[model samples]
Target chain A: MHPINRRDFLKVASFGGLVFASGLSGCASRAAKSEADEFYFVQLSDTHWGFQGAPNPDAKVTLPKAVAAVNALDPQPDFIVFTGDLTHTTDDPAERRRRLAEFKKIISELKVKDVRLMPGEHDASLDRGEAYKEFFGETHYSFDHKGVHFIALDNVSDPAARIGEEQLAWLKADLAKQAADARIVVLTHRPLFPLFPQWDWATKDGEQAIELLMPHRNVTVFYGHIHQEHHFKTAHIEHHSAKSLIFPLPAPGSQPKRAPIAWDPAQPYRGLGFREVEAEHDEYKLTEYPVVKA
Target chain B: MKRRTLLLGALAAAMGSARAEPEVIRIVARKFVFEPAEITLRVGVPVILELTAPEVAMGFDAPGLKLNTEIPPGKPVRLAFTPDRPGEFEFVCDVFCGSGHEDMGGVVKVLP
Candidate 1:
């Protein structure tokens, strides 16, 4: 084996922490004591239900396969969250609706109970998620679960997924309702901080959203857009991303353009699937399981 | 060095050439995305995408092609297919990473 550089090791460790464990050690142990709030959620991102292409010849079948894998999880997630890319195009309403209808069909095939969703640019591209709202709900909103404050934002509404003053204000009031010590978990289609602005990954007003979240004692954001599991911490808040259910993209800066990653036929279906985020109180652990774990 | 071996090799090459494919589009990957967002190739020819991602672990799924595949971090993936018709087919990342996902796409324009 080659020698692992400290930088790479730190990166690996950081990704391990984000992809698998909550960095704060104390919080991790704390979760063990509070079984009442011990809850888990499944992250399903970038389904792109209507997509068809060269990367895979069986995309139509694999999507449902991923959902089936999620449904087969042992403990069963309290709820399932779909981050974005529900469809492939932004301009075609008929395509969007057709894709969403297929999404609904596969989701209906889900053995799991509750499925929460946020719009990705592909789903909201044409009209800033106007159609998505009619199907899902408000673009951005909040809810509470077992003393945990959970908020979902609509950042992919515009070209840059601008959080805007309205959503920012809502986030502020939403956080104000917390007791200061309450652990907050946020969900959005885009990363809460600037991840890769060049690729339009960062929300234009993500900083404002981060500022709204900064006041909380324990803050973590779950998002999907990049198509892989990556996490970052800014201003004391942690931002974690989920993998897509459709195709995988190259990392930021590594390539000139972000497009569907192609694969060798012999070893196809290697790097895709769902992740399980389990937590209690301020601590959480995420582990991504490729669809075919064997 | 050997006359018999040379003749056999030449004959094999000829047979291969006779059945050679008319078209194939190749794709390359670096860190987190595809290199060519759009590719054009002759009709009825295979589109061979050379997929790659850096050391960071990631997976790949092509919903359109009915392909659910993974790109082992720090390696290469090559996908081949023949698009019988000409149009734009979209591919989205199946892995859960943030930022450039919805933007991750490519097109194959098969011309007559």
Candidate 2:
């Protein structure tokens, strides 16, 4: 804010993001929606709602800014999905509830008709989404959206942070039940394959997840724990890390302390924000936009 | 009544002959770092660090102070230490914070 007022910059920045969203209009608009091209969901990850720290003066502003960015997209998503870390620390149950309530308030401001949610380690750090599920829905479940089979896995539980034996089994059976031609999309808080175990990432049992999804022809894994955006391919499956609405984290093993990537005072909210995932015709397009410049 | 009062006064005087107990030092926390990072206290004084945070998890970490405790956000946690030697001790926030996190450091000063 020293160089420019935050709110003023936010207005200009948000307009810029909207402009960017509109500018990307070309590559995406050609993707045309169809009964076969039917699956589309927004990825909103790492919204550490209750984070209070010096990394950013307005921890409060970052989340709302991301939501505004998401809402500004021209083609409204079929539904929006929050990847996880609904709150920070995850110590107090009341604090968790309070933060989730605030999350709802912020999301309520959005015009998107449908929204789905999942938990990351921060939100479920202590209680493992016991409170999150109470407010949202089942942590790991699956549904179908326009000829595509969608599965949301719970991978932020306990130290191992696996999809759990039960959820993995459910995923295998769910995939087995789907038609061979159906597009498969898996959602979880952590990346399925090891992105950076040194950073306490990579699910211990993610290999099982990878094996299960490998059989599918076209499968895209959606995850949100890393905060910084990244994409990797393991065994024919597409894995992606979503940006957090909270503070950005350093790359895995980037620092010796093993702490999260901190905020950059000069480039605050740089790679931290939201993305629009549109599956249409023959391809899936993920267009990312920063919240601050939104 | 005079005899009873005299007996009570004598008992109180006898109890006062014991050595003095140690004093405690308190430190409060919120958001990122602890308050009064450089705590000054007697070598034998019991330094009781009362760390409080709203929703950001933080810890009271100090090696010279020989103290470390992870205080999950929203709850107040207390860390107690008694530095045997008098010198400079360092404290840091173990929780990963953005940007100014490395700066979320503190110091403890022990007196002879």
Candidate 3:
């Protein structure tokens, strides 16, 4: 693992020549930058700890590598957020517990101050996330840090993808406290929009959640579950889905069915990667890093 | 009277044949959703449900009728079963496809 300093962190953070709505380099130039000036966070999703298959022969190996990659990040991130699917699908109660426990034990190796987790259908929908919550606490909640409001929602907790009237009301009440101009980031397992109903990629009642968020001026959503990198612009909100730590799925409707792409021995961990987001007040820049260095 | 008895026998045999032959319904499962999301059939009649996915591998699971099968992309799997009662049986894609795996399901309505 390459040890990263603040300089090395900024060098990689400004990747791809991607520009934000505002200038982030200027924030980086300041010697004593305030917390709101610049901060970075890492997103790791779809680890699928218990997944054992041809698509990912070393599925377990990639996770520790991901943790080490984050730990090696220069300046380190404020925290690490795992989008969802900590474990593969399982119905047996004991197996479910075992998988969750194993996933927790493995992810605990991350050298970060805090690690936030959500749930994918594989982790939660079967038992309505009871097993997941028992390990990770509330599947959906909110917090504030460095003038940014972060909301974690559990759309997969219910197999039907219904957020329920209760959670919606809670969200409304939560948002009402924040000013309209507050920087907000929403996280979930599935795409909140109806990206493709046939594949279960959409939240059953996500429009309601979107409607509540529409009022916010600065809001971005980072989600996982699609197991690929995708960007969408809807109603002044930017939705980004990160790549999986395990395997990648076919593009939506690109094939007759949705299945994990077979792994290539020549290019191991080809589509498996994670994302780093650098936030500065109202602006945020994102860069995806593959588990295997190019 | 003999002619009337023959006529009655022929009518009963025709009905029996109709009951024995189930209607065929073809369903396609793709990313996140199923084509022909809802299907309706009559009770006491057998059905040949032809399930196929043109893209990747998927599965059809209707526990109510004890019907479950893996559907390979572009390969059709025919399931033959008779509806013994009238009700709606929900069938889900038992196989994981992607993020939308959970939403890949529809209702099989058995009508009286």
Most TM-score-accurate candidate: 3
Write one digit per residue (lDDT tens) for candidate 3, span B8-76: 999999989867666789999997788999999988777899988998777787767778777888899
lDDT of residue B37 for candidate 3: 91
Each predicted complex: what DockQ? 0.02, 0.03, 0.06
Q: Give me candidate 1's TM-score against the actual structure.
A: 0.67
- Write model 1 residue lDDT over A167-280, tens digit each, in one string: 788788888888655778898988877676545566767888887777777888889988877767785677777777766778775775666688557756655677778875
TM-score of 2: 0.64
| lDDT of each residue in B2-71, candidate 1, tens digit only | 9999999999999999888644444544334666766666667665666666644334444445544456
Docking class of 2: incorrect
Alpha carbon deviation, residue A252, candidate 2 (Å): 2.5
- Each prediction's TM-score versus the true structure: 0.67, 0.64, 0.70
For model 3 chain A, where is the 10-residue window of minimal lDDT? A1-10
lDDT of 3 by residue, A167-248 (tens): 9999999999987767789988889887765566777678999999988877888999899877776667778888999999
Fraction of the reference Cα-Cα interface contacts (below 8 Å) that each candidate reproduces: 0.00, 0.00, 0.00
Give residue A96's error in model 3 in angstroms: 0.9
Candidate 2 regions exceeding 4 Å error are A1-39, A260-262, B1-112
Native-structure RMSD, model 2: 13.3
Give Cα distance to truth, residue A294, candidate 1, Å: 3.7
Per-residue lDDT of A75-181 in model 2, one digit per residue for the tens? Answer: 78888988877777544678779988888888898888678788877766457567777788788888877756788888875423657788888888888887544
